[model samples]
Target chain A: EERPPPRGLTAPTVAAGAIAKKWLAEHFGVKIRGYMSQLGPIVIPFQSWDEVENNPFYAPNADVVPELEAYMDALRKDGDSIGARIEVIAENVPAGLGEPIYARIDAEIAYAMMGLNAVKGVEIGAGFESVSQRGSEHGDALTPDGFESNHAGGILGGISTGQNIEVSLAIKPTSSIRIKRPSINQAGEPVEVQTLGRHDPCVGIRATPIAESLLAIVIMDQLLRQRAQCGSDWLETKEQE
Target chain B: EERPPPRGLTAPTVAAGAIAKKWLAEHFGVKIRGYMSQLGPIVIPFQSWDEVENNPFYAPNADVVPELEAYMDALRKDGDSIGARIEVIAENVPAGLGEPIYARIDAEIAYAMMGLNAVKGVEIGAGFESVSQRGSEHGDALTPDGFESNHAGGILGGISTGQNIEVSLAIKPTSSIRIKRPSINQAGEPVEVQTLGRHDPCVGIRATPIAESLLAIVIMDQLLRQRAQCGSDWLETKEQE
Candidate 1:
């Protein structure tokens, strides 16, 4: 969103959000979306941002809403918090957008996610699950048509592989609980600390927008770097190839 | 070392290298050093830069030189390559020099190290070794005098802990080997690929200076960031405290 200009001044024009999305689709045929995969202990089964926007405690199955509400109520009563998982996907991301050996797209995504508040872990594609998978199963099979799978999370050897980019983040429970916690003071003496004032019992409930913003920032950064290193026609040349 | 100015032009003077070292010692009591921990497969047993400067293949024990020479000869004959490890240490780094959650000192260092050519892995303090150790053994014990050990590598919770920062890097074998390999052509046809021209048999042999330079860069960046966020008198105030 663009901020309003001062009374006597005109703000610089820039495309952002829906406008940027439309521009990208028209120019590069790229589409990006962010959604929650899990809220606390419940897993989301459907892709519906409208449902989530309508209700912060939105669950795919209508029957699960009451159960989630009850669980949240219990957590609030006990002065506790819960964790969540989020996923962001970019369809038709341009290949070779990443700088390999260091500033890889996956590495940049990890850095951005970890920088977010309460983010404890990050995964691309199969991630930790690949540890249990065999090489034959883990590697995406290449075909004349396209890749048979997306286990690499749209990246291969630190570069985009022309598949949908899938990134997941593990957000830890909010720490500012009402319950008293034992901690050491500046003087190294024992202290009982209790949080006061407004606090989020589950910070991840409102983290979708922040996560999406981070992805946008990283993508923009990569685009600038790519243009600087590969020239302005890099994307057009790649598309032709 | 400062760059010499052009004829009839005065250059802005800034402390660097030995002068910077002297200045830091005089003002803040900080000492930084970078050295090779291993050359190829040789693990250095002594800290000696003079010895390394005299000979890039300098091994702690003189008896191992002939064996290492033989190994290098074999690699050259086979048109293969080997790897090496390097370490850099900064003593008495002021506490709280790093930004938390995002621009952590360790994360920045990792980024810098990974950006180096042929570097495949990075470690801080105990690093991967801690994976096999129990929590009790891995965590550094705090005492009245100071930390019993520095397993955290001078950083905890993304902030500097005032301990010596210890970083190690794993340099992979040079990819530009003389040996021929199979590869795909632009038309997706099979072909044999062979590298020609001057190439280092071991890129890591020349990586010491580069690694040291990167550490200096990251440290200087952190210092600037710390000053900007915590005020120009941050280091002075930290020292006084």
Candidate 2:
């Protein structure tokens, strides 16, 4: 290839990590035994696998490094793997954050979450639980103050209704394992090799901040779009009133 | 009722006209007609018909003084009234203007055009005429310089391929005509009133520039989006190279 792969992914990953650190500092107000280890089998930037044989988590007695490593090692000992889930909640969102026709907020949010690695699916408030409820039960009733219920997730007609918007994602089990497994080589030949290395028992264990960053990207884009189209007029009218 | 009889229709007409004017100014270079006769028929701004009767185009010849008499007379005598059509052709558009997936450039352009008033349908370069063309004739062959033919209208994969983007819209016939027809009032009472006064013979005549404006909005939006996601990186990478 004439051009090398771009390093654009670095900026977002760094930004997400910074956000997570700030959240931890502000809310938890405590230092933990370990850091959020990004367990990775592959990096999308270069489309290459990272060797984890020398990783601290791979050490049999890596408890000296961090207790989380011990937890990850024990999970790796078993054939089973772990999975991660990331929840993103945004508060103080103004009403009307989306457009009608095709530019729906839910659709955009879903796309953002789905674009993440190992993320199987995403859901708004109540998720698929809404499907089991009756119309009266699920439909959020409006009041002078605001919605009496939040089953609607602060969105109606694809626009935000000046409430907290929330979303969650289900991450799939990490694929790497130490056990022997069937595989194919570059020549398209069937082969088998015993994998040896440390990996995240659940890849999603560290993806929370990544999900938050994705949500941030979606919200920022929507904010810009809404402001460009109708925000100025709405502000002017409100000022006149 | 405090509201006028034609409740639902009133707001949309004014809104559509205002949006149409803004769209024209931003996207196309054409200046809106300055004279009084050019106003869309429904721009009465109020429910009063007396105001409509006062318009030079609507007034009878009695008080139609010399200043506005000829214009009013032309409205009555012309078997078909005059309408305007605005055409917008984007020149020197760069290659690769749109993204894949639902945000395809052509679809966005079509959606924007359809949003405009009186725009029944839209067509791209050569439009339906291309259906009759053979593959060899219709296909824009590649060459060292670029495409040998402009039949594709400078779009491929919903992206601009460094060619002029051509679009046209068909405006429907104006509903308010001089001829009398069966109709129902807001009270569900049957009534017949001749659509007295001057109106465009064909609604599409003035639609060209409006269509251009819609196209421009879509193009500008897509350009900004493309810049944010892809072009910014491109610039950085080029500088590095």
Candidate 3:
């Protein structure tokens, strides 16, 4: 018998929403607030992916705290998924901390964001929208009053322009579902399984703070590297003899 | 007969200086600057050690554009050598780009320096000298205006503290000598051969710019990454509204 190629089928959003609502009422209502209150805003500290995979619980999602637990529970009961937006803001960055040829800043950032669990895509300040604007319109104009705007996202020549940088990520829906699916089991045997577990319908809810933590570690590593060379500019100051 | 390990012997500074001076006049002085200037500083961008073996010119001592005619003339003369000190300086850098962590900026800088060919050691912001200072004296105190002092070398917690980064290196004398020496050839046959080509008596003379170029790259990378995660902290109230 000939097998059909993979078909393009979208997940049933309404059905998923109803299931989510039931799951939230049955398991999440009481626990969500407690967990949220205990953790509040979360920050992942590990830089390497090995460290993160070794202990996923160490960096829990910030939105899962008490302040937002009720809403999350309600969301679960409604069978509708909610999205989380996190901003990893940093200050006091030094200039000249990136490689030119292959290890450019943009390349590293993109890799880091993609590494997050549910991050579908990343944008560095008005990213895709820039394509619609003219060069003069999109270019971050230099001005005596500082940059006219932040279209360049605080980077020039792949180096820090001493301005605040901004990035946003769009997370996708979680893959796990309670509904039955045709899938190959561990032995490559055909099997029918309905996933049953405590999980977010949208995994992106946990990705926000994790992105912030990785950025911190990368920045710290690069700063030390910069200081190792040419950190000094003035020496023989005319020896005021 | 079993050969005994060589005994440690100290040569007189005068003798060392004389040998160094003679070598500098005979070999390095002939065209060291010409080689370095043409190459435009010494940082080698390579993926791995295998790539390095594939390309010998990557070694700090290897010259890209050799003054062949002048070098041959010097090689024809009796044994001679030379040495030089190349200094690099980066000016107008902001403070507070690094943190004290597994990825300290100073440590990374040292690693880069050691990564270079024949580089013995690296130092940062009066490096080892700070070890002798008291806490009150060594610490960079913050003033309402700025810093009253900067003994910490513009760093704290492996992160930059918004100050000028400073670093230096000690370049070693080149190992290849014109005088005959015992060595094993590719066939594992022991033989004596005077190096026929002209090489830098000391490689440090061309190190300054290479170090600067790498430092620039690392700093720029970190700054951009930091901005992406944390630069949005300063978002205006209008956006919040």
Candidate 4:
């Protein structure tokens, strides 16, 4: 929404939780990571995971890592904060975790992301851009590369295509800004509001860890839900017989 | 996906199935409808339910109703077909029908819509455009009129906001075009292929009934799933005591 609710940074809790759940995923060989791709106008293109881990912004671009401090100082001076686009990528996620027509992999991911504070939009691979694409250019042609492209975003017909699944979310600018803005009070009277407290200049900067935590929760939840509903293993055993 | 498997319009069956299920939903006063909002280049803007029912496209706008024919004729001349964007609106739905984080109303709706043939994208309310929106402008203010805007698409924190649920899907152009195209056969050799059959120029033109049926299935599934997962009525009754 235009304004997320004013609150202290819940970033610490999200990070702590993610750290705990990460171990569970590691046991299963599922790896998940999140990184900042955009901070207002400063875009740090995706590179390698090693570089993203080393950077202060959790961005793959080394150049933008050093520039984040100066940008935050400027943002603080203006009583404003920058928004962000953060991406979460999951590798080695098993196929068929989601159910069709309701609990698809991408759909569940979108739900998890949209539930986060300040998240205004969510998209799977090649999402909104697909609006302008033609069939030939957009279709994923098969080659020795196990399908020449990933235009399908690792999921087809609601099931994982055994490719790395990527999800992106657009986080709105932090609402708890030092700047004054118009708002209606509890009784619906117009008033000017300026939030007070030490707040993160770009909350998106802290979003990576939180996004990973949510992704882990969704994956695990879907795994259990599918078992409860369909007993996928039972069907497999029956087929083998 | 750019190419949904070629098949005849299954509109009649979808409509009949929905009619059969409508009785069950009637028990709860829930009503759902799907309509075309965009056909190739012709756009029928959402207006009112009364007028949408009167139009052949099931679109809210009466203005574009008569213009669909010319666009399809123009599409056929080039051996190409158009795509579509359709919307499904569900009214009188009870609140708290979906689960948090993984099975939110909007997320489930997106999953259902994306499962349809030729569907490439899904959005709820203001969706992707929310990427560019300011928090102040995007936040729906509470008024006696319910909500001043629908930017959130009638769901909040993964629960129903007790308003009309709106979902939209982008359907890719039909892949079975008469125009010849280069492709690989089963043996991986290059060949020119041309499809011959009766095809709807835009499959989305017939997606309204299918979408409605799918939406019905999702709602019913959620209802039963919720009941199965937790005895909702018993818990509520116990709380009252």
> Could you tell me the interface RMSD of model 4?
4.2
Q: What class would a CAPRI assessor give candidate 1's docking?
A: incorrect
The DockQ ranking, best first, is 4, 1, 2, 3
Model 1, A167: alpha-carbon shift in Å?
12
- Give the DockQ-based CAPRI class for model 3: incorrect
User: lDDT for model 4, on a 0 to 1 scale?
Assistant: 0.67
lDDT of 2 by residue, B1-241 (tens): 1222222222444455456546434443323221112222322122332442344333222232343345335644643232222234566455676754446666566555544443333445544334233223444555444556765565654567767776644333344455454445666566654455545544443454345455555665665576687867763442243
Write model 1 residue lDDT over A1-241, tens digit each, in one string.
1233212101111223445455455556777677667766576676555565556653334545676678778878877666677777778777776866658776676656655545544556765444233333444555545667887778655677789988776665655666665555677666656665566667676666666656655666677688788887986675554
TM-score of chain A of 2: 0.67
What is the model-wide C-alpha lDDT for candidate 1? Answer: 0.62
- lDDT (Cα, tens digit) per residue for candidate 3, span A55-84: 223223433234455644654664444333
Q: Give the lDDT of residue A30 in candidate 4.
A: 71
lDDT of 4 by residue, A1-241 (tens): 2355454335654765476467536544678888888877777777777888786688887767767778778878877766788888787766666655556676667655666766656666665554444444455555433556766666766677667777877776665666676666688776667776677767787788888887777776766676577797843442343
Question: Could you say which candidate leads in lDDT?
Answer: 4
Candidate 2 vs candidate 4: which has greater lDDT? 4
Model 3, B1-241: lDDT tens digits are 2233222111232244344334333421311111121111223332342332232233233232244224324633535332222223333344455443444555455444434443333344534333223222334445444556654445444566556565544444343546564544566566554554545543444454455554554454454455565665522221232
Task: Give the DockQ of candidate 1.
Answer: 0.06
Better structure of 1 and 4 per lDDT: 4
What TM-score number comes out for model 4? 0.69
Q: What's model 1's lDDT at A94?
A: 79
Tell me the TM-score of each prediction against the true structure.
0.56, 0.39, 0.34, 0.69
Report the number of the highest-DockQ candidate: 4
